[model samples]
Target: MSSSTLFSPLTFGDFKIPHRVVMAPMTRSRSAQPGNVPTESMATYYAQRAGAAFIVSEATQITPQGQGYSFTPGIYSAEQVAGWRGVTDAVHAAGGRMVLQLWHVGRMSHPVFQQGQAPVAPSALAPNAQVWIVDEHGQGGMVDCPVPRALTVSEIRAIVNDYYTAAANALAAGFDGVEIHAANGYLIDSFLRSGSNLRTDAYGGSIEKRLRFLDEVTDAVVDAVGAARVGVRLSPHITQRGMHCPDMIVTTLKAARRLSDKGIAYLHFAEADWDDAPPVPESFRRDVRRAFGGAIGVAGGYTEARAQAVIRAGWADWVAFGRPFIANPDLPARLRNHLPLTVPDTHTLFGGDERGYTDYPNAG
Candidate 1:
């Protein structure tokens, strides 16, 4: 057996995890159409990977307005909640704990998904990003995002309430907890970065003002389901899709401190994972550790050795793996046994049937 700390157990909020391997939230876009509900195939897919210490489910939209990609699941309607209940039940029956990731895409959406209306953001700024969209003919392609309209203050508060409702729905659907998707260049991330949020209102201007929306959303989710059941995902170093904020590091650190004060369960960082992506500085990692006292998780391109190094240094409590878990359902077992991982077929990464979803075999 590997003598790495990655196999060590740790107390994370409500549950005591067996290892430091976390199945990161990945968007596969395989939800049933017309209502964007979870399917039986998704349940099998997650249940097959139940050997992980814990799973952070795919990004589930809080409302229809939060959807940016095609075929992604939601947690808004009763039918959707029932659909997820099946998935969570399967995971739990397989002896695993799972958390639902609540998401709002904001300006990352297209008019086609927005009912011919412009998408809403903190300001009327376009991220110049593209979201995967499927047309009436069932053809999927990347579509450029258009400029969004600034959200009224009342509308912002309504979105916060939407998060609260989503958290409640997650618990009702049998989720162990809910992770607020405040990462990437999504709605909450845009509000945090000065480059996208040019609003002169109470929701923008200074860093504190920009953080107000996230604070309210977190508070609302905490109210819906206690602080121990809440986690926040932030991407301070991911400067893609027009998310170049000069003061993002500082803003993220301040947000981390506030989330710590709220007594949230964990704070996850979605670092840039591409081969050429800039590395997350060690100084910033140290600073974040000082800022947030709760469990800290990080997701990027982490290998076993790298994950062990970070955990040993006390920089992160756990390591979340994304693509690695796609083709290797029994990822934790494979890693522990030093087995070779199966490579995922890129063509079937999103919006596909079970060919690439649950077809991977365990290394028995």
Candidate 2:
């Protein structure tokens, strides 16, 4: 059990990574105009950090209905697909692998951002925290979440198809794979959380029923992109966007055990919160590893020591660095060379130019 093991090669499906370092999905919200397409600058941003064994891009909305924020990328339209082609090509040129994050924000959106359209969710519940609403010019404004309208069974089916269409679009765009965003209290997470989903239909009520939305979407994505190229991003036992389950550990195990049987390339688990999330107790990570022998990548506030510990302990196949990678684009090299690290500018964390996005110093 040593820190060096974190940098070891690990195989996930057909992709054999030279290291266990992964760049987690980050919401840079920097996509260029008209449908929030990926830009050339973003390509340079990702290509610079191509050293990661795996790179999951920021949340890409499935469609206009799936979008919850402005200036974020999407995979629904042909133009959007073409835009991402530039990114995928750049990452490949740099010898890196990248996966597109498929997302739907559910009640996390504002009417102001969605062309005055009301947000939709499993129930008409409002999120406990307020979302940052963006104006036409992408100006950030704070507003309390409005109660969302419950989707009918038919609309739910349409939403599922939206995910499929986006997955197909992702493949056509030349992405290596797709990661379904089933966490962070998004649409899938909203339906998964008992606090958010209060319906008594086949899509809600019991744990088995509650997990249906996520399962259907996963099956659709896998079918469209092949399971080997489809990964899942899940935040279990964590209360982001006011997620609370009666018994998270039990619920998650029951839901995920079946997913493990379905043969996904990997499971990217966000065990806890960024600030107050409880530590991933030895037992929790071990249990997941035992349940799914497939590749498992863990993310959160972690150091080189902690990342290596998880890998050495055989609890996780890879470790994803969030803010550390934000401040240090050359994080893998920095860790390998034991270079100095800089503190990220909190103010520039969201909505800014290259000052904090692609301008991070490299380990020369």
Candidate 3:
């Protein structure tokens, strides 16, 4: 298979990447506890994989109320910001450009992480989803999501402001830019789908209304950080619990136009990647290209051949590799030379210090 297109240079917003292989954000749960702050080990982990043209840091909560999983990093607190500073510094020192993903779990969160209060959402609905959490005993496991409280109009405005604050914090932490995590059945994704949002307010009912929340958040974030430095992640096909909607494709395409109007840097599509994952229609890809003027990045179970094909076809500008970058820190170099890759150990995928993290060796 021809992998030549993967090495082509591309300009994303203000950053010029030397190659088209990007690093997708993967949660490793290796952050320091007590405050859910990033650690120096996390810095080393990112620095080790600086071969990637661009790196999107793991989903970092915008505030305490935004956190859904334990040990994930945050950007709201001073300590958290300082912790992330080291991470960005390390990645930059290795000559890698990086962006921080701003996140809010919404109803995906459990009361255990919310100080005994129900998680907030666009509507008071249960996703029947589960999130990974660590108890006081330090045992981590998945627990079912509880029904969330409907957010009032005022509360929605506050959350939008929270996104703005987080974007500013990300810049201060030394990131080149920020990406709004509006995918994978998270807060913004849930708000954009009908199955999860059943409100009669201005932020619900019609497709335009369901998309209102995302628009507001995007506007706020772009306002805080210039649109040139802002990007957004969207999953048009994933039906991860409480996120399935009949018109997801149509809705997402319409939203793409809105994002394009804002002149944001890029649109990162989180495609389904599981063994039985459904395929994204080529029509959708073509339509997205027509709607957006900026670059497009795609992630999910992409092989070297498939990634090259997508870029060659002009359907995507860059490809993001999640698990492959975990075990092969020099993935771009390995792919450049057509070398074999090492599979990561599933057991040490999360909550570890550095065994499966920074210990991954470069190609011989």
Candidate 4:
């Protein structure tokens, strides 16, 4: 497949980039301890990968209650906001556009990260997922997720406000835009899928009810920042952590239409990347395009050639590369020149120092 489409310049919202390669947000869990703050070293990490058309920062919690994993950054505090400013400044200084992903882990969280209280979700069911947590000794390990408490209608409204505040903080931190983390069995995804959201209130039961949280969150975000600067990420086909619903495809198409009606800037699909993950059907892609006449981004285990083919075929407007960018800071250049790529060290992927974080060299 030709790489012309992948290497060509593209415009997303008010930001124009040299190419169509987006750097997907991968949680490295390297934030500073005590405050879950981004650091200068994190800035260096993003600055080195300025070659990406746009960089989506790893999921940053909107509030302490939204946190699930250890060492992830947050956007709800002044010090944390200042910490993220360093990252955004570095990316901009390197001539790159970047966005922050606002997240709430919901039922995926452990009580340890939630002030010894149960995590909040649309229902009290456990997703049977595990979250990374650090002990007072500074050692980190995975623990089973506890059954969460379902949020009240009032509580749901408060979280929406938290997302709005997070969007404002992202702008204050100097990001070009913000991507709402509504996918991957997180808070919003929990609401959207039936397996997790069993509430009978206005927020659950039927598909429309299940979609209420997403609609409210999107509306609050689009109102905070203009529609052009707001993006939403979804995983219609991913079955991770009991997120699969029989009507996932249909529900996602409806969600796409709703998001499109709101005039969102883009819709990102976090495709399943497991070796045996289900393939995104071509028919579903066509339906998504018809339903949402906006830029579409797909991320999974896409190679340069595969990404180009999808873009050329109009299945996606752009492609986001995740783990590849971890080991190849200048990934766009390497892909452009057909240079050999390096494999990322899995050991240092999460909660690590500079070993596999900023130590990767450009192709020589």
Give model 4's TM-score versus the native structure: 0.98
TM-score per candidate, in order? 0.98, 0.95, 0.98, 0.98
Worst 10 residues of 4 by lDDT: 1-10
List the candidates ranked by lDDT, beginning with the highest. Answer: 1, 3, 4, 2
Candidate 3: regions farther than 4 A off:
1-4
lDDT of each: 0.93, 0.84, 0.92, 0.91
Alpha-carbon error at 209 in model 3, in Å? 1.0
Residue 18, candidate 4: C-alpha displacement in angstroms: 1.8
Q: Compose the digit string of candidate 3's lDDT tens values, residues 1-364.
A: 2343999888868879999999999999988878998999999999998889899999999999998988889999999999999999999999999999999999999988889999999889999889998778878889999999999999999999999999999999999999999999899999999999999999999999999999999999999999999999999898878687999988989999999999999999999999888777888889999999899999999999989999988899999999999999999999999999999999888796789999989997
lDDT of 1 by residue, 1-364 (tens): 2343889998867867999999999999999978999999999999999888899999999999999999999999999999999999999999999999999999999998899999989999999999999888988999999999999999999999999999999999999999999989999999999999999999999999999999999999999999998999999888888999999989999999999999999999998888988778899999998999899999999988888889888899899999999989989988888999889999998898999999998887
Candidate 2 regions exceeding 4 Å error are 1-4, 136-138, 273-276
* Model 2 agreement with the true structure over 1-364: per-residue lDDT tens digits: 5443977777777678989888999887788876688888889889888888878989899988787776788898888899899989999999999999999999998886667777999999888767765676757766777888899999999989999999999989888999999888899988987989998999999889998998899999988988888888888767857788776666677666867888888888876645766687788777777777578888888788988888888778888888778888888888877888888887776666887888887877
Q: Could you give candidate 4's per-residue lDDT for residues 194-245 as a string of tens digits?
A: 8888898899999999999999999999888888998899998887798868
Q: Is candidate 2 or candidate 3 better by TM-score?
A: 3
In model 1, the runs with Cα more than 4 Å from the true position are: 1-4
Error of 4 at 167 (Å): 0.1
> Whose lDDT is greatest here?
1
